[model samples]
Target: MKKRFWIAIPIMAFGLGWPLLAQENPTEPQPQHAQAQAQPAVSAPDVKSPGTPQLDAADLEAWLDGYMSGALEQGDVAGAVVSVVKDGRPLFAKGYGYRDVASKLPMDAAQTLVRIGSTSKLFTWTAVMQLVEQGKLDLDADVNTYLDFTIPERDGGPVTMNDLMTHRGGFEEGLKEILITDPAKFITTEKYLKDHMRPRIFPVGKVPAYSNYGTALAGYIVERLSGEPFDDYIERHILGPLHMERSTFRQPLPEKFQDNVSLGYMSASQPPQAFEMITSAPAGSMSATADDMANFMIAHLQQGRFGDARILKAETARLMYQPSAPHEPGFTTMAHGFFSGPINGKRLIGHGGDTIWFHTDMNLIPEEGVGFFVSFNSRGKNEAVYGMRERFVEGFMDRYFPDKGNEPLPPAIQSAQADAQALAGKYRSSRRIDTAFLKLIYTLQQSTVIANEDGTISFASEPGTKYRETAPGMWRDPNSEGALHVSTVDGQLTITNSKNPVSDMQRVPLAESAGLNSFILFGSIAVILLALVAWPLSWWCRRLYGQTLGLTGRDLVAYRLSRLLMVGDMIYLLGWYMALQPLFQMQFDGFGTALDPLLFTLQAGALVPLIGVGVGLWNAWLTVRSDRHVMAKAGSVLFAAALCGVAWVAFIGGLMSFTLEY
Candidate 1:
């Protein structure tokens, strides 16, 4: 969970927006081939309600029973907990599915506790705002003022409290041990932040990268200022006052509650997993029951008052909901750690979280005075939890607050084709790592915009859902509140969407395109492999017929050296892949200190490619100058060029770096 929350690398940070890799969908959004929409796919509800349906305990339960029962079973979700509050009252709270499938123990909303991943950040943000209200912290002041350590400045400026809350810290994603199996290796919040102070990739408050480290930093600051451990302060101030007895930020949970925590599973049929240990605790470490979560949600909906308790002043609670100034027109913005999305013609403020087997979403409709929280124990097939939750949100909105959408026929605009053509390209999410090998995630996750023949744009992130140019540079999803606003920021095209306010997609320039990078990497490796394999195969064939060698003297020496260098390049790549590949493959349970020495050795291997480039150039020059066959000369030149590609890919991808932070 710390992976985005590494604090979960996904916005889905909490994929928690990762393990910022798991997602609201509880799985990375893989790029899929799609057909251009003659009509847009269902991104939201289409049923036009004649009038608002009455929402009460009985109807709400009936609605949930009708929808969730089939959804959980059809999706293969093991179990779930759902809690909803209206007018500061829990209108509905229930648990569906088994808490323990092996024992067939049914889930209980008040008894079963689930880890509420990145949604835990709301408490950290609330803690910061509490200090702000007391004049103990400055939102605009440098965060360094409150900490013992320092954060280096970049594009945005000195990191500020406001910046962390808005998730604009721009720290590069790093560290693999988001969820460690061993409790003995757990690190303190302060220690984790100090050690993993991810390099600032964006200027102060420039881009929102959904930082778990940044949020954890705020929690550390709260610990420092409040003169208490983060967990203790939370227990004394927030949880105690809200009467959320079932909630606790303690890792592994307190012994008393351990038995009550529901087991997590990748699938219902799979074995239950160990407790996910998030050392960066404050970022996404909280377990609570549906009843307790409902109470916490009610506090936010009622301006921080729960029963007789007050966690925040009414104004402070109100302040927390203020959306950041819009960077793109109609694009929802992150506000004080809340994903302030304007859905169904009303502002919904909340956050979503994922921790491998468990996925959850907590949202509050401030204007409507209602809050909804849901959690699924299993990711289910194809991360179908995303669709289930989406269906719930849209269905609820349609029943309670329907939006009178436009006519079915897409509007005809003369410039739609031009706009579509111009916008057609790949865009990388700002949440990706800029200074480490984790940036490789960008290659697979980069969102592509394909221009459809019908003058619409198909966003790869929302496959099969065509977005028409609703305005000049803005495209609206016909089915949902999702909007993609394309604008030029410092001459670079930035695509900001309403669905994910925490991160935006910047147009991937040709030099940085994943397609180009992959081509260079694979094509170069293939060139080296060809020569390496042919050298011995040619000798074997010659010996079979007892043929005499054609080349002699300097040609023989240069050719031998070229083949040797190619072997070195291959060895260099293989060693590095062995060292770093697991970090990519294992997102949920990251590797520990065992990889340090191996990584150091791999760093030393960077020299092999450097030397190969020089030797390859000489080989190319000798063969081109000599009377070698045309194919041989071409192969030599290609070999040289392959070494050059390796060097370029290594430099830009940070594979050659000595730093082992990630």
Candidate 2:
């Protein structure tokens, strides 16, 4: 087990809060059971559709009322705003529930503002495109060309704007100090970029690891090229033109818009927390109302011009909406800033976002000149919010654009059982913590991709979903028609839903192969606890019997020292766990330098158990030489062995490493 200690440490980490980290398959456009013959592939906004009845306004309103009212009550979500735009006009824009529950102020879709989170990246990307249209920026050029400080080339390749836009820049995901509670600590974009440059874990343009840092770096480049502050550049070139008067990217928002800001809650029952200050503001910080967002969406849907304001030229806008990376057949691809996928046979480009306590989604059906936006004020950790978003979109699509049916694909692969077996295993997301005890979460919660004896792969994390090999190394969900492309890259088993592999779940070594560490850990804890209780009882029993048969001197001292070591080990584990408990409850931005002292103490204290290993071994040798029973000698060896296993597990788990930087 000691020799196998190095197997589990993966150099990866993920965001603490949502900032577009999870990559879900795009919604299927055609129903799986539809019998219509397959039609030729269609580009976005131009998919041919059998004409259907237009959505009735009154019926839509009634349906929304029923769904929103029920969802708000059942999910315990505080409030929400819904906006729908079609044919360059606002079809619906309204708020449901309260904006400020204590004051009983109702939400106002045109006035009340909520944090838009990662969806704010659209504005940053839009600004970049505007500059590119003017030849002030280059999408394919090395980003270092515009930066004051050079970004070191990885594998002889410089990261380009295209790589950043497509989320294939290879930077490891970041979390620490990314979100700060205090506005004062929210440093400038340049400083934030410099202080938190992540290590590149994948080669450029190879993987799709969602990165807030990469987005922020793009924003910084925009600032440098435009010779203006990022917020100012966006306001002048994007927001101001679109007449989004109620939207802002500033933290602690401008005084006039502050009162309209909706409070964020963990749940409807929980008290509201203060507005968070995103350290990477360009990635996930923007506050806007439903109407303001509607206006912005209209601009994108209409080829960059909204009313009299124009953000990007037609060609640039078209380029921005196009896929930046390759994708699986029948799957969505990464656009410049948006995620483009099919819905009800209609091509849609959209973005979804989440702050600690707010969740939102925005999608545009360009051909229909329609866009939908929904945002909830509560985080709703039970994921009721996510369910609501998916259901709402699906229902809306089904009603307005019911599948005309499509030609079914060819027969499923029925002879790939061997291939399926080869791919079966427990796999962890590449986006995970490497240097912190948080890494244990991935180890324990990795997805189990099982190869069924039947020629299908069972995705255990999402039960009821299975895949069949549609190609040599490609699998497709027969029901949804979504695809999963797999291959071995650099000896790692990589699985991707789209063109770029987002996660590589290396085959985990069997527990037995890894020195049987899991069993050793369990046995060690059990043995040490028993010894802690039994040692004291043994001493008292001897005193009661007035026996002097036990050994003294070095043996007694070593025995006493071993017991003290167990006390230290217990204190370290328990103390560390207790300290981390309150942290999980605190706001995402609330963790920072304040947590260093306790973490350092716990790390330093874990070494005490290593001392126990030495003391236990000494005691074991003396106990065997003494006039002790055979059972007593066996117990000594077991206790000493347990001490070694305990120390090894702790060390490998990073419980003993001292680093406050996370």
Which candidate should be chosen as best, given TM-score against the real structure?
1
**Which regions of candidate 1 are displaced past 4 Å?**
1-12, 15-52, 327-329, 407-416, 443-445, 461-463
lDDT of 2: 0.71
Q: Could you give candidate 2's per-residue lDDT for residues 270-345 as a string of tens digits?
A: 7888787777788878999887898887778778877766788989999999888877665667789777877657
Model 2 misplaced regions, further than 4 Å? 1-53, 150-153, 404-415, 498-527, 544-558, 609-642, 656-658
TM-score of each: 0.89, 0.86
- Model 2 misses residue 656 by how many Å? 4.8
Error of 1 at 55 (Å): 1.9
Model 1 agreement with the true structure over 196-216: per-residue lDDT tens digits:
778887776667677788888
Clashing pairs in 2: 1-515, 12-432, 13-432, 29-344, 29-345, 36-406, 37-407, 38-407
RMSD of each: 8.5, 8.5
* Backbone clash count, each prediction separately: 36, 8
